[model samples]
Target: MASATFPLLPSAGRRAGLILARRTEPHACRLSPRFSTTPRPPSVPPDVAGRRAFDLRDERGEDNSRAQSMGTLLSHAGLMPHRDGNEPLSPPIELATTYERPPDGNYLLEDGRGGGRVYSRTNNNTREALERAVAEMEVWNPTRRRPKRRVGEDRLSDGSTTPPMADSDTALPPPPALPVCASFSSGMAATSAVLLSLNAPVRVVLPDDIYHGIPTALHSVFRRHGVKWTAVDMTDTDGVKEALSLSVAEVEGTDGDVVLWLETPSNPLCKVTDIRALCELADQVRCGGGSDVDGGGGGSCGVNITTVVDSTWAPPPITQPLLLGADAVLHSATKYLGGHSDVLMGMVSASSATSSGRRLGAALREVQSAAGAVPSPFDAWLVLRGLRTLDVRIRRQCSNASALAEFLSSHPGAGRVHYPGLRSHPGREIAEGQMSGGLYGGMLSFEV
Candidate 1:
């Protein structure tokens, strides 16, 4: 479990590089369907442009009935642009800090994938690809496996990655909209973007025991900017409801934002917050259904409540907060997503499930560029590499953590072992309900 320290030259371009240090732990750590156990079709020769040498199909020329696993998604993420045999298998690092404008003077990008990249600080292909990969994986459902790609199926056929509309009445409800993602220089930057993106006069509800950095940011930095926050026991549904109610009541008539910041399988303590329950409560307050908090009057349209979950401890295929009704989800890619301790990056994915979520996503994109806290193209590319193996690494980590937790719980010297997988753990049931495949996570803690 050695740690690596590397100079991270951000988009800001500093002569003295900012060092990003990461501990590449076994606990913290994908492949394509083409290499699956299922039989594969014979490979075809590459075309002139060197693309689509072979189709991803079985011997019968039938698409695999299995839904594309998370592992495959991670391994193949950010590889769309390279699907052609002509391009490099790995994502290319676009080193240019700026792109030339078209001769016609129009800055719009026709690809729609890389929106008008006039400057690297605001936009870069490397960073945007990672954002799209994260957003797409965040919404993927493992339980309801869709058959592998139909012959002519394209995720962006509708000009977006939304799942195509179902043809029959028996079709499942349309999945939640794919979230919008923004990458940052660090986890704190991502958190700050969400807090800073809010209109002034904001109230942020935080878990009493959570990531120290977030509370630090709010108290020391954001507080001076008219942002208010209260720490509540997130597991206590009533207490959380009260805190949101009171915070909203204080800003009853004003135009502002209330953010419920959650960290699940929370840092050190392994506290699992009921994301869906709290999100429902926040919605009730946002819609002014909490009559006691605001004199039973209609909810203030001026006051907005947003639920953001910092799932740094729980990466995808482990837990998806946005799918659980969160307005957004944040991850410190430097930790688990990067997996190799070589990249320093953060991600903020705003859910498109709600109108408020949509607005938050738009605002966050603006803050990312305006604040200029963008990660370097190299750092972003590193994360893309890390993502390729995330599925296998984390599953193994979770398996290891489960064993460690069991041993600790029975040890004579150990006082307490905290892990969601354990039956004795307070949040075990909730974790089982939310976490995919009953995989609690890699984080565990104990005191002797």
Candidate 2:
């Protein structure tokens, strides 16, 4: 009844990079090995919870504090210790991105049964494995120490990292799983997928000042497709409600299935909405501002509508919409997820309520396959590679942005600078509520 163990993997956390080593033993890997030597903390602190051990760091030469947040064992130090027969998947390379079946007479596209992978897209080992993990562990019941979120990386004093997928601790629970996870060629493709699944001619409620793409796509593309749109001043619920009413009263039917686009610390402006409150309104499909409305509308009034937020702005770790009650979530992976603007990809992380969430996933995948918009395995690989450094990147970006903002604010040349980290920011209060934990984020804009 002994557990399989792994080895110590480490790197300097300058950027996210992983190191993998193979172990051939007398048992020919009869049992899983243990990799991590981090002694379990004698007693984890209440206010302080972070990953601390230096076998590896993402891209940063320092240790990754977030990666350590999940009780993640970076080293495959202990593996399949409780397996019955044996670890079924060997080569872990076969576990790479696909599998193959015997090329028998039974192999036909129409009647393909027991056939191996028809295509990598239909069945990618790495992506599927990741999807499986997402489906199983999408719930957000994070604790001080035993957090549900983990990437299991082993860091060292050098600049190499080991991913948590290398450890069993990375396999998440299943309640978060659904049948679909739609990936897109770019941010536009992902948002387009949302438009396609929703059946156009409907108005999309957006923050008056948000990402330029929404309007660009809405006008050039979506409008051509019969999709109408409106903008909301998301200062408070009531203001959003006024915008919703203006949009709704102009349209027909039982409010219809409208889409609410959320972009907190909105692009350029850095304006934010209390997602928790907004999501509550969205769930009820109501709109109106509460007394919190800045100047548009006062009193306790709010609105609700089908809610979708571009997590790309703040990213997930900084702010999580699914936990707040987002019907569907989208990410322009190109921005932060890709870390480098080089690769272009978008993702729709959906909840179970929206079938388009599922449908969009399938449809997007189909489009990607048909149009060859499918992210190259290499590109996808690179993106996954970048993800390991996300926390470090974001934190660094925040530091850089904050420093820049401070420099501008104190400058007489600067007219008005809007950054949540700055005390003068109107949305700072709301931003503080969600983006706690000593992280102000990396992208802050200034106005000259």
Candidate 3:
């Protein structure tokens, strides 16, 4: 009997935008016509103790030398191995529902033999590629490779060029652990995974203008499991702080935990929340900084406070929540990430700042594997293909959205225009300071 192994990506170093596949020794399965003629790595790295499912390498060595621009990262994040030389330009879809299992009862073989990968629901090469692609986007530091803006692109009131909101000097550093993103069947499934992964008796502080699905889920399904939530104006940092303080006091002396749920450039309303400010507040509550009289009164000193941002409406290059200190960032890949409206997927990427935050990725992975709420391999491939054009698509979307918002605002029939890019927007100042390149986002709503 021959033993086989599947190596996805490396665990350490610059692991973004790399994919590898190998078959150890020869077996009857090797002759199957179902297998494509994908080139193999010249050699697979020795298996380390803590190696993970995905270990794609950026053979070009560009990922390790310098940070690439958002456009470049998106273009190559989910890069497949080359054809004959070793790496691929595009990903090959692996639609096998099940892989060969070992004759022995043990399925825990470190190598690919036996039941190492018994089911496709839990482990799929195509899906994991999508996860790695999105994870790269989430963790990429735009400050590392700031693109030079064109003339008259974003001038200030004083006729000076408006500096980028997130610059190299001011941007937050990368987290200790490499960011790990988990892909789910749908956006709601991704949201549910985050809530379920948390310790029970949880209280989620939700934004008043968030997508309706969140509140509906909390009230319908999650409430039965002791999951409670409260809605507040997230734009008002003070109001958000008050909500957290009260939530902690209410759950004091119990195993109750808190999650500050944020949806920036909120759905329908398009109101922007100060993600950095709220994340800092969550940290203060988690680390006991909010124990003073003005704070949460010591009850929140050691309480677990997780900050999650639902940036579905404002995807990357425009807003990177993890870099702004969020514990985890969620994306409804069904939208921008899958641009052509042909796929349904969701992603939740964990930040590596704190111990718990670092473990969050693995925790989400557990929930994903157990719950089996994962997207099909084909859907994952579609999203991966869509990622390559995300930067260009988003730029044009933002430009068109801004123009439409202006036209609506000027129309006498329109009552109110809701867009963070407009000066009339109340959160325009915070949005200007938080959003990169002065490009607000593609979503806007107006009252007629």
Local distance difference test values of all predictions, in order: 0.80, 0.58, 0.77
Question: Which of the predicted structures, 1 or 3, would earn the higher TM-score when compared with the native?
Answer: 1
Model 2 alpha-carbon drift over 4 Å, by segment = 1-116, 129-141, 144-180, 246-256, 286-304, 353-372
Error of 2 at 70 (Å): 5.6
Q: How many residue pairs clash in each candidate?
A: 4, 74, 15
The global Cα lDDT (0 to 1) of model 2 is 0.58
**Candidate that beats the other on TM-score, 2 or 3, i.e. the better one:** 3
TM-score of 1: 0.79
- Candidate 3, residues 122-210, lDDT tens digits: the string is 88888878887787777677555342222233443344443332333433454334577899989999999999888777998999988
Choose 1 or 2, whichever is better by lDDT: 1
Candidate with best TM-score:
1
Q: Summarize candidate 1's per-residue lDDT along 7-106 as a digit string, tens digits.
A: 4455543433343445575232112233245877775443411222223334456534455689988988676564532356687898899788887666
Instruction: Return the TM-score for candidate 3, rounded to 2 decimals.
Output: 0.74
